[model samples]
Target: KSTVINALEDLSFYCMENLPFDLIESALDHLTREKNGPQRFAIGIDARDKRFVKEFKNLTEKLRKKFRLDVLFLSSSDEVLAERFSTTRRKHPLLDVGGELIAAIQHEINLMQPIELAADASFDTTLWSPHYLARKAEERYSGADLHRKLQVTVVSFGFKHGMLKPADTIFDVRFLRNPYFDPNLKHRTGLEPEVAAYVFEDPATDIFMEKIVDLHSFLLPAYYLEGKHYFRIGIGCTGGKHRSVALAERLVKDLAAKKIPNVELSVSHRDVMIGQGI
Candidate 1:
Protein backbone atom coordinates (compact mmCIF):
# COMPACT_ATOMS: atom_id res chain seq x y z
CA LYS A 1 0.00 0.00 0.00
CA SER A 2 2.79 2.39 0.82
CA THR A 3 4.43 1.42 -2.44
CA VAL A 4 1.33 2.54 -4.36
CA ILE A 5 1.29 5.89 -2.55
CA ASN A 6 4.96 6.48 -3.19
CA ALA A 7 4.58 5.60 -6.85
CA LEU A 8 1.68 8.00 -7.23
CA GLU A 9 3.53 10.81 -5.46
CA ASP A 10 6.42 10.31 -7.86
CA LEU A 11 4.07 10.28 -10.88
CA SER A 12 2.13 13.37 -9.81
CA PHE A 13 5.08 15.63 -10.64
CA TYR A 14 4.78 14.75 -14.34
CA CYS A 15 1.08 15.61 -14.64
CA MET A 16 -0.03 18.75 -16.49
CA GLU A 17 -0.71 21.65 -14.13
CA ASN A 18 -3.78 23.06 -15.96
CA LEU A 19 -5.83 19.88 -16.33
CA PRO A 20 -9.23 19.51 -14.57
CA PHE A 21 -7.01 18.12 -11.78
CA ASP A 22 -8.67 14.74 -11.27
CA LEU A 23 -5.49 12.76 -11.84
CA ILE A 24 -3.33 14.88 -9.58
CA GLU A 25 -6.11 15.11 -7.00
CA SER A 26 -6.57 11.37 -7.04
CA ALA A 27 -2.86 10.88 -6.58
CA LEU A 28 -2.73 13.27 -3.66
CA ASP A 29 -5.95 11.96 -2.19
CA HIS A 30 -4.15 8.63 -1.74
CA LEU A 31 -3.15 9.64 1.76
CA THR A 32 -6.78 9.64 2.87
CA ARG A 33 -8.10 6.63 0.89
CA GLU A 34 -8.69 4.60 4.06
CA LYS A 35 -7.94 1.04 5.29
CA ASN A 36 -7.96 -0.72 1.91
CA GLY A 37 -5.86 2.11 0.47
CA PRO A 38 -6.54 3.48 -3.04
CA GLN A 39 -9.82 2.62 -4.69
CA ARG A 40 -9.95 0.01 -7.48
CA PHE A 41 -10.50 1.35 -11.01
CA ALA A 42 -11.16 0.01 -14.53
CA ILE A 43 -10.57 1.25 -18.08
CA GLY A 44 -13.45 0.76 -20.52
CA ILE A 45 -13.07 0.82 -24.31
CA ASP A 46 -16.23 0.54 -26.42
CA ALA A 47 -15.73 -0.06 -30.16
CA ARG A 48 -19.44 -0.18 -31.05
CA ASP A 49 -21.18 2.21 -33.44
CA LYS A 50 -21.67 5.83 -32.33
CA ARG A 51 -25.41 5.21 -32.79
CA PHE A 52 -25.44 3.55 -29.40
CA VAL A 53 -22.53 5.60 -28.01
CA LYS A 54 -24.89 7.70 -25.88
CA GLU A 55 -26.43 4.63 -24.30
CA PHE A 56 -23.00 3.08 -23.80
CA LYS A 57 -21.72 6.25 -22.16
CA ASN A 58 -24.61 6.19 -19.70
CA LEU A 59 -23.92 2.53 -18.93
CA THR A 60 -20.20 3.25 -18.29
CA GLU A 61 -21.14 6.15 -16.02
CA LYS A 62 -23.28 3.80 -13.97
CA LEU A 63 -20.16 1.64 -13.51
CA ARG A 64 -18.47 4.42 -11.56
CA LYS A 65 -20.11 3.32 -8.30
CA LYS A 66 -18.58 -0.14 -8.71
CA PHE A 67 -15.24 0.89 -10.15
CA ARG A 68 -13.33 4.06 -10.85
CA LEU A 69 -13.85 4.28 -14.64
CA ASP A 70 -11.69 5.69 -17.42
CA VAL A 71 -13.36 5.93 -20.80
CA LEU A 72 -11.50 6.05 -24.15
CA PHE A 73 -13.24 7.68 -27.13
CA LEU A 74 -11.81 6.51 -30.46
CA SER A 75 -12.48 8.21 -33.77
CA SER A 76 -10.95 8.80 -37.22
CA SER A 77 -11.11 11.40 -39.99
CA ASP A 78 -14.30 11.38 -42.16
CA GLU A 79 -12.49 10.23 -45.31
CA VAL A 80 -10.55 7.59 -43.39
CA LEU A 81 -13.65 6.49 -41.45
CA ALA A 82 -15.76 6.21 -44.62
CA GLU A 83 -13.07 4.24 -46.43
CA ARG A 84 -12.85 1.79 -43.51
CA PHE A 85 -16.65 1.55 -43.09
CA SER A 86 -17.16 0.97 -46.83
CA THR A 87 -14.38 -1.61 -46.85
CA THR A 88 -15.92 -3.34 -43.81
CA ARG A 89 -19.55 -2.74 -44.87
CA ARG A 90 -20.53 -1.81 -41.29
CA LYS A 91 -23.51 0.35 -40.31
CA HIS A 92 -22.87 3.71 -38.68
CA PRO A 93 -24.62 4.75 -35.45
CA LEU A 94 -26.20 7.93 -36.95
CA LEU A 95 -26.07 6.86 -40.59
CA ASP A 96 -28.53 7.91 -43.33
CA VAL A 97 -28.68 7.35 -47.13
CA GLY A 98 -26.51 10.44 -47.63
CA GLY A 99 -24.91 10.55 -44.17
CA GLU A 100 -21.13 10.85 -43.97
CA LEU A 101 -19.33 8.32 -41.83
CA ILE A 102 -16.99 11.05 -40.58
CA ALA A 103 -19.96 13.18 -39.50
CA ALA A 104 -21.43 10.34 -37.49
CA ILE A 105 -18.10 9.67 -35.78
CA GLN A 106 -17.84 13.36 -34.89
CA HIS A 107 -21.42 13.38 -33.63
CA GLU A 108 -20.62 10.35 -31.45
CA ILE A 109 -17.56 12.07 -30.05
CA ASN A 110 -19.65 15.17 -29.31
CA LEU A 111 -22.35 13.16 -27.61
CA MET A 112 -19.71 11.47 -25.47
CA GLN A 113 -18.47 14.84 -24.13
CA PRO A 114 -19.99 14.31 -20.69
CA ILE A 115 -18.27 10.97 -20.25
CA GLU A 116 -15.02 12.24 -21.79
CA LEU A 117 -14.92 15.25 -19.49
CA ALA A 118 -15.49 13.03 -16.46
CA ALA A 119 -12.84 10.59 -17.58
CA ASP A 120 -9.39 10.41 -15.95
CA ALA A 121 -7.87 10.54 -19.43
CA SER A 122 -8.75 10.26 -23.11
CA PHE A 123 -6.83 9.31 -26.25
CA ASP A 124 -7.30 8.88 -29.98
CA THR A 125 -6.66 5.20 -30.74
CA THR A 126 -5.86 6.05 -34.35
CA LEU A 127 -2.65 7.75 -33.18
CA TRP A 128 -1.70 5.21 -30.50
CA SER A 129 -0.10 1.83 -31.04
CA PRO A 130 -1.80 -1.32 -29.73
CA HIS A 131 0.99 -1.79 -27.16
CA TYR A 132 0.72 1.84 -26.09
CA LEU A 133 -3.07 1.54 -25.82
CA ALA A 134 -2.78 -1.56 -23.66
CA ARG A 135 -0.19 0.16 -21.49
CA LYS A 136 -2.43 3.19 -21.13
CA ALA A 137 -5.35 1.04 -20.08
CA GLU A 138 -3.15 -0.63 -17.51
CA GLU A 139 -1.83 2.67 -16.23
CA ARG A 140 -5.33 4.09 -15.81
CA TYR A 141 -6.82 1.03 -14.22
CA SER A 142 -4.75 -1.96 -13.05
CA GLY A 143 -4.60 -3.50 -9.61
CA ALA A 144 -4.09 -7.04 -8.42
CA ASP A 145 -6.67 -8.70 -6.20
CA LEU A 146 -9.18 -6.09 -7.36
CA HIS A 147 -11.03 -7.12 -4.24
CA ARG A 148 -8.00 -5.85 -2.25
CA LYS A 149 -7.58 -8.75 0.12
CA LEU A 150 -5.84 -8.02 3.40
CA GLN A 151 -2.06 -8.50 3.09
CA VAL A 152 -0.63 -10.37 6.03
CA THR A 153 3.19 -10.28 6.05
CA VAL A 154 4.89 -12.66 8.46
CA VAL A 155 8.27 -11.28 9.45
CA SER A 156 10.77 -12.49 12.07
CA PHE A 157 12.66 -9.78 13.98
CA GLY A 158 14.85 -9.86 17.11
CA PHE A 159 13.45 -8.06 20.14
CA LYS A 160 16.68 -7.17 21.95
CA HIS A 161 16.93 -3.86 20.14
CA GLY A 162 13.25 -2.98 20.15
CA MET A 163 9.90 -4.08 18.76
CA LEU A 164 9.53 -4.12 14.99
CA LYS A 165 8.59 -0.73 13.56
CA PRO A 166 5.29 -1.97 12.10
CA ALA A 167 4.42 -4.42 14.84
CA ASP A 168 1.01 -4.24 16.48
CA THR A 169 1.97 -6.48 19.39
CA ILE A 170 5.16 -7.63 21.12
CA PHE A 171 5.93 -10.60 23.40
CA ASP A 172 8.69 -10.49 25.95
CA VAL A 173 10.71 -13.54 27.09
CA ARG A 174 13.34 -11.79 29.15
CA PHE A 175 12.26 -13.67 32.28
CA LEU A 176 13.87 -16.86 30.95
CA ARG A 177 17.42 -17.25 32.22
CA ASN A 178 20.27 -16.57 29.82
CA PRO A 179 21.66 -19.72 28.23
CA TYR A 180 24.75 -17.64 27.38
CA PHE A 181 26.00 -18.16 30.95
CA ASP A 182 25.87 -21.93 30.77
CA PRO A 183 29.42 -22.96 29.87
CA ASN A 184 28.42 -26.33 28.36
CA LEU A 185 25.56 -24.82 26.30
CA LYS A 186 27.05 -21.37 25.59
CA HIS A 187 28.16 -22.23 22.07
CA ARG A 188 24.77 -23.64 21.07
CA THR A 189 21.84 -21.84 19.43
CA GLY A 190 18.17 -21.83 20.40
CA LEU A 191 17.62 -24.52 17.77
CA GLU A 192 19.72 -26.90 19.85
CA PRO A 193 18.03 -29.16 22.38
CA GLU A 194 20.43 -28.11 25.16
CA VAL A 195 19.45 -24.45 24.89
CA ALA A 196 15.79 -25.30 24.44
CA ALA A 197 15.79 -27.51 27.54
CA TYR A 198 17.42 -24.84 29.69
CA VAL A 199 14.85 -22.23 28.69
CA PHE A 200 11.75 -24.45 28.79
CA GLU A 201 12.63 -25.98 32.16
CA ASP A 202 12.17 -22.70 33.96
CA PRO A 203 8.80 -22.35 35.77
CA ALA A 204 8.61 -18.58 34.96
CA THR A 205 9.10 -19.36 31.26
CA ASP A 206 6.19 -21.79 31.37
CA ILE A 207 3.82 -19.25 32.96
CA PHE A 208 4.89 -16.43 30.63
CA MET A 209 4.44 -18.53 27.52
CA GLU A 210 0.96 -19.61 28.61
CA LYS A 211 -0.16 -16.05 29.25
CA ILE A 212 1.24 -14.68 25.99
CA VAL A 213 -0.30 -17.52 24.01
CA ASP A 214 -3.66 -16.81 25.60
CA LEU A 215 -3.40 -13.16 24.69
CA HIS A 216 -2.77 -13.97 21.03
CA SER A 217 -5.45 -16.66 21.12
CA PHE A 218 -7.86 -13.92 22.19
CA LEU A 219 -6.69 -11.06 19.95
CA LEU A 220 -6.33 -12.78 16.57
CA PRO A 221 -10.02 -13.61 16.18
CA ALA A 222 -10.97 -9.98 16.79
CA TYR A 223 -8.61 -8.87 14.04
CA TYR A 224 -10.38 -11.15 11.57
CA LEU A 225 -13.67 -9.33 12.10
CA GLU A 226 -12.07 -5.91 11.66
CA GLY A 227 -10.90 -6.73 8.11
CA LYS A 228 -7.26 -6.77 9.11
CA HIS A 229 -5.27 -9.06 6.86
CA TYR A 230 -1.79 -8.20 8.08
CA PHE A 231 -0.22 -8.34 11.50
CA ARG A 232 3.33 -8.70 12.92
CA ILE A 233 3.89 -10.04 16.38
CA GLY A 234 7.38 -9.46 17.78
CA ILE A 235 9.07 -11.65 20.35
CA GLY A 236 12.04 -10.13 22.15
CA CYS A 237 14.51 -11.10 24.83
CA THR A 238 17.70 -9.56 26.25
CA GLY A 239 19.91 -11.03 23.49
CA GLY A 240 17.38 -12.68 21.15
CA LYS A 241 19.58 -15.80 21.16
CA HIS A 242 17.89 -18.15 23.57
CA ARG A 243 14.65 -17.12 25.19
CA SER A 244 13.32 -14.98 22.36
CA VAL A 245 14.23 -17.50 19.67
CA ALA A 246 12.77 -20.39 21.64
CA LEU A 247 9.54 -18.57 22.38
CA ALA A 248 9.18 -17.44 18.77
CA GLU A 249 9.70 -20.99 17.50
CA ARG A 250 7.21 -22.29 20.04
CA LEU A 251 4.62 -19.76 18.97
CA VAL A 252 5.07 -20.76 15.35
CA LYS A 253 4.68 -24.43 16.27
CA ASP A 254 1.66 -23.90 18.47
CA LEU A 255 -0.12 -21.81 15.84
CA ALA A 256 0.71 -24.27 13.10
CA ALA A 257 -0.25 -27.29 15.22
CA LYS A 258 -3.69 -25.76 15.70
CA LYS A 259 -4.06 -25.45 11.91
CA ILE A 260 -4.92 -21.74 12.15
CA PRO A 261 -5.44 -21.42 8.37
CA ASN A 262 -5.49 -17.70 7.51
CA VAL A 263 -2.89 -16.59 10.01
CA GLU A 264 0.84 -16.36 9.30
CA LEU A 265 3.68 -16.93 11.77
CA SER A 266 7.46 -16.54 11.52
CA VAL A 267 10.39 -16.11 13.89
CA SER A 268 13.78 -14.38 13.78
CA HIS A 269 16.67 -13.79 16.15
CA ARG A 270 17.95 -10.23 16.49
CA ASP A 271 21.14 -10.78 18.49
CA VAL A 272 22.21 -14.33 17.88
CA MET A 273 25.76 -13.06 17.40
CA ILE A 274 26.32 -12.40 21.10
CA GLY A 275 29.32 -14.41 22.37
CA GLN A 276 28.51 -17.76 23.93
CA GLY A 277 28.84 -18.44 27.69
CA ILE A 278 29.10 -14.74 28.44
Candidate 2:
Protein backbone atom coordinates (compact mmCIF):
# COMPACT_ATOMS: atom_id res chain seq x y z
CA LYS A 1 0.00 0.00 0.00
CA SER A 2 3.00 2.29 0.43
CA THR A 3 3.54 1.96 -3.31
CA VAL A 4 -0.02 3.13 -3.99
CA ILE A 5 0.21 5.97 -1.50
CA ASN A 6 3.44 7.14 -3.14
CA ALA A 7 1.77 7.03 -6.55
CA LEU A 8 -0.98 9.35 -5.24
CA GLU A 9 1.63 11.68 -3.78
CA ASP A 10 3.18 12.10 -7.23
CA LEU A 11 -0.21 13.32 -8.43
CA SER A 12 -0.04 16.17 -5.85
CA PHE A 13 -2.25 14.61 -3.18
CA TYR A 14 -1.49 15.58 0.39
CA CYS A 15 -0.55 12.25 2.02
CA MET A 16 -0.54 11.20 5.65
CA GLU A 17 0.86 7.73 6.27
CA ASN A 18 -0.08 5.64 9.30
CA LEU A 19 -2.09 8.47 10.81
CA PRO A 20 -3.97 7.80 14.04
CA PHE A 21 -7.46 6.60 13.15
CA ASP A 22 -9.27 8.81 15.68
CA LEU A 23 -7.72 11.97 14.21
CA ILE A 24 -9.15 11.45 10.72
CA GLU A 25 -12.06 13.93 10.88
CA SER A 26 -10.15 16.58 12.77
CA ALA A 27 -7.25 16.39 10.37
CA LEU A 28 -9.46 16.85 7.34
CA ASP A 29 -11.28 19.72 9.00
CA HIS A 30 -8.00 21.55 9.63
CA LEU A 31 -6.71 20.89 6.13
CA THR A 32 -9.92 22.21 4.58
CA ARG A 33 -9.81 25.40 6.64
CA GLU A 34 -6.33 26.41 5.40
CA LYS A 35 -6.28 29.15 2.74
CA ASN A 36 -4.33 27.19 0.14
CA GLY A 37 -4.59 23.63 1.32
CA PRO A 38 -4.52 20.65 -0.99
CA GLN A 39 -7.76 19.69 -2.69
CA ARG A 40 -6.77 16.03 -2.90
CA PHE A 41 -5.59 13.78 -0.08
CA ALA A 42 -4.58 10.14 0.47
CA ILE A 43 -4.64 8.73 3.96
CA GLY A 44 -2.90 5.42 4.65
CA ILE A 45 -4.47 3.05 7.17
CA ASP A 46 -3.47 -0.41 8.34
CA ALA A 47 -4.08 -2.80 11.22
CA ARG A 48 -1.22 -1.29 13.20
CA ASP A 49 -2.52 2.27 13.35
CA LYS A 50 -3.63 3.44 16.81
CA ARG A 51 -7.27 2.62 17.56
CA PHE A 52 -7.65 1.42 13.99
CA VAL A 53 -10.37 -1.17 14.55
CA LYS A 54 -12.25 1.05 16.95
CA GLU A 55 -12.33 3.99 14.53
CA PHE A 56 -13.41 1.83 11.61
CA LYS A 57 -16.19 0.22 13.61
CA ASN A 58 -17.45 3.43 15.16
CA LEU A 59 -16.87 6.20 12.59
CA THR A 60 -16.61 4.87 9.00
CA GLU A 61 -20.23 5.61 8.26
CA LYS A 62 -20.12 9.09 9.76
CA LEU A 63 -16.92 10.01 7.88
CA ARG A 64 -18.22 8.69 4.58
CA LYS A 65 -21.31 10.86 4.89
CA LYS A 66 -19.24 13.93 5.73
CA PHE A 67 -16.66 13.47 2.96
CA ARG A 68 -15.89 11.52 -0.18
CA LEU A 69 -14.05 8.90 1.84
CA ASP A 70 -12.75 5.72 0.31
CA VAL A 71 -11.36 2.62 1.91
CA LEU A 72 -9.23 0.64 -0.54
CA PHE A 73 -8.30 -2.59 1.16
CA LEU A 74 -5.08 -4.12 -0.21
CA SER A 75 -4.23 -7.73 0.47
CA SER A 76 -2.00 -10.55 -0.76
CA SER A 77 -1.68 -14.24 -0.10
CA ASP A 78 0.04 -15.05 3.16
CA GLU A 79 2.76 -16.95 1.29
CA VAL A 80 3.57 -13.96 -0.86
CA LEU A 81 3.72 -11.69 2.15
CA ALA A 82 6.10 -14.08 3.89
CA GLU A 83 8.35 -14.29 0.85
CA ARG A 84 8.52 -10.51 0.59
CA PHE A 85 9.51 -10.17 4.22
CA SER A 86 12.27 -12.71 3.69
CA THR A 87 13.54 -10.96 0.58
CA THR A 88 13.54 -7.53 2.21
CA ARG A 89 14.80 -8.96 5.51
CA ARG A 90 12.37 -6.72 7.36
CA LYS A 91 10.19 -7.67 10.30
CA HIS A 92 6.46 -7.80 9.79
CA PRO A 93 4.63 -4.84 11.35
CA LEU A 94 2.59 -7.16 13.49
CA LEU A 95 5.34 -9.53 14.55
CA ASP A 96 5.40 -10.05 18.28
CA VAL A 97 8.41 -10.99 20.34
CA GLY A 98 9.31 -14.63 19.53
CA GLY A 99 6.50 -14.88 16.98
CA GLU A 100 6.93 -16.88 13.77
CA LEU A 101 6.82 -15.08 10.39
CA ILE A 102 3.82 -16.99 9.07
CA ALA A 103 2.03 -16.49 12.36
CA ALA A 104 2.52 -12.75 12.17
CA ILE A 105 1.19 -12.53 8.63
CA GLN A 106 -1.87 -14.61 9.51
CA HIS A 107 -2.51 -12.59 12.64
CA GLU A 108 -2.61 -9.29 10.73
CA ILE A 109 -5.00 -10.75 8.20
CA ASN A 110 -7.33 -11.97 10.93
CA LEU A 111 -7.16 -8.64 12.73
CA MET A 112 -8.10 -6.59 9.66
CA GLN A 113 -11.01 -8.79 8.60
CA PRO A 114 -13.56 -6.18 9.61
CA ILE A 115 -11.98 -3.48 7.50
CA GLU A 116 -11.81 -5.82 4.53
CA LEU A 117 -15.51 -6.61 4.79
CA ALA A 118 -16.35 -2.90 4.85
CA ALA A 119 -14.02 -1.75 2.06
CA ASP A 120 -15.70 -0.31 -1.00
CA ALA A 121 -12.97 -1.92 -3.12
CA SER A 122 -10.39 -4.62 -2.49
CA PHE A 123 -7.26 -5.41 -4.49
CA ASP A 124 -5.39 -8.68 -4.28
CA THR A 125 -1.79 -7.95 -5.26
CA THR A 126 -0.19 -11.37 -4.98
CA LEU A 127 1.65 -11.18 -8.31
CA TRP A 128 2.01 -7.42 -8.64
CA SER A 129 5.40 -5.75 -8.58
CA PRO A 130 5.70 -2.45 -6.78
CA HIS A 131 5.70 -0.44 -10.03
CA TYR A 132 2.72 -2.35 -11.37
CA LEU A 133 0.88 -1.71 -8.09
CA ALA A 134 1.72 1.99 -8.34
CA ARG A 135 0.20 2.20 -11.80
CA LYS A 136 -2.90 0.31 -10.69
CA ALA A 137 -3.26 2.62 -7.70
CA GLU A 138 -3.33 5.71 -9.93
CA GLU A 139 -5.97 4.17 -12.17
CA ARG A 140 -8.11 3.18 -9.20
CA TYR A 141 -8.02 6.41 -7.15
CA SER A 142 -7.34 9.42 -9.38
CA GLY A 143 -11.04 10.38 -9.74
CA ALA A 144 -11.84 11.93 -13.14
CA ASP A 145 -8.28 12.96 -13.93
CA LEU A 146 -7.80 9.72 -15.83
CA HIS A 147 -7.08 10.95 -19.32
CA ARG A 148 -3.60 12.23 -18.48
CA LYS A 149 -0.66 10.98 -20.52
CA LEU A 150 1.63 8.15 -19.44
CA GLN A 151 4.13 9.33 -16.85
CA VAL A 152 7.61 7.76 -16.55
CA THR A 153 9.82 8.29 -13.52
CA VAL A 154 13.57 7.76 -14.05
CA VAL A 155 15.43 7.08 -10.83
CA SER A 156 19.20 6.83 -10.30
CA PHE A 157 20.40 4.77 -7.36
CA GLY A 158 23.50 3.02 -6.01
CA PHE A 159 23.79 -0.73 -5.63
CA LYS A 160 25.60 -0.13 -2.37
CA HIS A 161 22.55 1.64 -1.05
CA GLY A 162 20.44 -1.52 -1.59
CA MET A 163 18.19 -2.20 -4.57
CA LEU A 164 15.45 0.38 -5.09
CA LYS A 165 12.01 -0.95 -4.32
CA PRO A 166 8.99 -0.53 -6.65
CA ALA A 167 10.96 -0.12 -9.87
CA ASP A 168 9.43 -1.40 -13.10
CA THR A 169 12.74 -1.56 -14.96
CA ILE A 170 16.27 -1.52 -13.59
CA PHE A 171 19.49 -0.99 -15.58
CA ASP A 172 22.96 -1.45 -14.17
CA VAL A 173 25.51 1.12 -15.36
CA ARG A 174 28.32 -0.18 -13.17
CA PHE A 175 30.20 -1.38 -16.26
CA LEU A 176 30.57 2.24 -17.35
CA ARG A 177 33.71 4.16 -16.47
CA ASN A 178 34.29 5.06 -12.82
CA PRO A 179 34.29 8.78 -12.16
CA TYR A 180 35.03 7.94 -8.51
CA PHE A 181 38.55 6.98 -9.56
CA ASP A 182 39.22 10.50 -10.80
CA PRO A 183 40.23 12.84 -7.98
CA ASN A 184 38.76 15.93 -9.62
CA LEU A 185 35.44 14.18 -10.33
CA LYS A 186 35.13 12.01 -7.23
CA HIS A 187 33.41 14.71 -5.19
CA ARG A 188 31.11 15.77 -8.03
CA THR A 189 27.85 14.11 -9.11
CA GLY A 190 26.43 13.22 -12.49
CA LEU A 191 24.14 16.26 -12.33
CA GLU A 192 27.26 18.32 -13.08
CA PRO A 193 28.12 18.73 -16.76
CA GLU A 194 31.75 17.71 -16.23
CA VAL A 195 30.80 14.39 -14.60
CA ALA A 196 28.19 13.68 -17.22
CA ALA A 197 30.55 14.51 -20.06
CA TYR A 198 33.21 12.25 -18.57
CA VAL A 199 30.83 9.34 -18.09
CA PHE A 200 29.35 9.55 -21.59
CA GLU A 201 32.73 9.98 -23.27
CA ASP A 202 32.84 6.20 -23.63
CA PRO A 203 31.72 5.17 -27.12
CA ALA A 204 29.81 2.19 -25.69
CA THR A 205 27.61 4.54 -23.62
CA ASP A 206 25.87 5.97 -26.66
CA ILE A 207 25.53 2.55 -28.27
CA PHE A 208 23.93 1.12 -25.13
CA MET A 209 21.48 4.00 -24.91
CA GLU A 210 20.45 3.47 -28.51
CA LYS A 211 19.31 -0.09 -27.74
CA ILE A 212 17.61 0.96 -24.49
CA VAL A 213 15.71 3.81 -26.14
CA ASP A 214 14.60 1.49 -28.91
CA LEU A 215 13.41 -1.09 -26.43
CA HIS A 216 11.31 1.43 -24.47
CA SER A 217 9.92 2.99 -27.64
CA PHE A 218 8.47 -0.39 -28.44
CA LEU A 219 7.28 -1.15 -24.89
CA LEU A 220 5.74 2.14 -23.66
CA PRO A 221 2.87 2.17 -26.14
CA ALA A 222 1.74 -1.24 -24.94
CA TYR A 223 1.78 -0.04 -21.32
CA TYR A 224 -0.26 3.05 -22.19
CA LEU A 225 -2.73 1.02 -24.21
CA GLU A 226 -3.31 -1.23 -21.20
CA GLY A 227 -4.33 1.83 -19.13
CA LYS A 228 -1.14 2.06 -17.10
CA HIS A 229 -0.39 5.68 -16.19
CA TYR A 230 2.92 5.31 -14.35
CA PHE A 231 6.31 3.62 -15.00
CA ARG A 232 9.58 3.79 -13.09
CA ILE A 233 13.02 2.98 -14.53
CA GLY A 234 15.85 2.44 -12.07
CA ILE A 235 19.48 3.09 -12.99
CA GLY A 236 22.17 1.80 -10.70
CA CYS A 237 25.95 2.01 -10.44
CA THR A 238 28.54 1.48 -7.72
CA GLY A 239 28.03 4.81 -6.00
CA GLY A 240 25.20 6.72 -7.73
CA LYS A 241 27.49 9.77 -7.75
CA HIS A 242 28.42 9.56 -11.40
CA ARG A 243 27.74 6.71 -13.83
CA SER A 244 24.18 5.77 -12.86
CA VAL A 245 23.03 9.35 -12.44
CA ALA A 246 24.61 10.35 -15.75
CA LEU A 247 23.03 7.46 -17.60
CA ALA A 248 19.62 8.06 -16.06
CA GLU A 249 19.71 11.73 -17.07
CA ARG A 250 20.81 10.78 -20.58
CA LEU A 251 17.97 8.28 -20.82
CA VAL A 252 15.43 10.97 -19.88
CA LYS A 253 16.86 13.31 -22.49
CA ASP A 254 16.89 10.61 -25.13
CA LEU A 255 13.27 9.68 -24.43
CA ALA A 256 12.20 13.34 -24.41
CA ALA A 257 13.88 13.82 -27.77
CA LYS A 258 11.75 11.03 -29.17
CA LYS A 259 8.73 13.14 -28.14
CA ILE A 260 6.65 10.00 -27.97
CA PRO A 261 2.96 10.86 -28.08
CA ASN A 262 1.09 10.95 -24.77
CA VAL A 263 4.16 10.59 -22.58
CA GLU A 264 5.57 12.73 -19.74
CA LEU A 265 9.05 12.31 -18.22
CA SER A 266 10.68 13.09 -14.89
CA VAL A 267 13.98 12.08 -13.22
CA SER A 268 15.37 11.86 -9.70
CA HIS A 269 18.80 10.84 -8.37
CA ARG A 270 18.04 8.99 -5.15
CA ASP A 271 21.42 8.71 -3.49
CA VAL A 272 23.51 11.44 -5.08
CA MET A 273 24.77 12.78 -1.77
CA ILE A 274 24.98 9.64 0.35
CA GLY A 275 28.59 9.66 1.47
CA GLN A 276 29.17 13.34 0.82
CA GLY A 277 27.01 14.31 3.78
CA ILE A 278 25.61 17.15 1.70
Q: Write the per-residue lDDT of candidate 2 for residues 61-114, one digit (tens) a residue.
A: 666555656678999999999999999898787887229999988988988888
Runs of candidate 1 with Cα error greater than 4 angstroms are: 1-163, 274-278
What TM-score does model 2 achieve against the real structure?
Answer: 0.51
With a 3 Å backbone cut-off (N, CA, C), the pairs that clash in candidate 1 are 51-93
- Quick one: best TM-score, which candidate? 2
User: Model 2 off-target regions past 4 Å?
Assistant: 1-146, 275-278
Question: Which 10 successive residues of model 1 have the least lDDT summed?
Answer: 13-22
Which residue pairs show collisions in model 2? none
Which lDDT values do the candidates have, in the order given?
0.56, 0.83
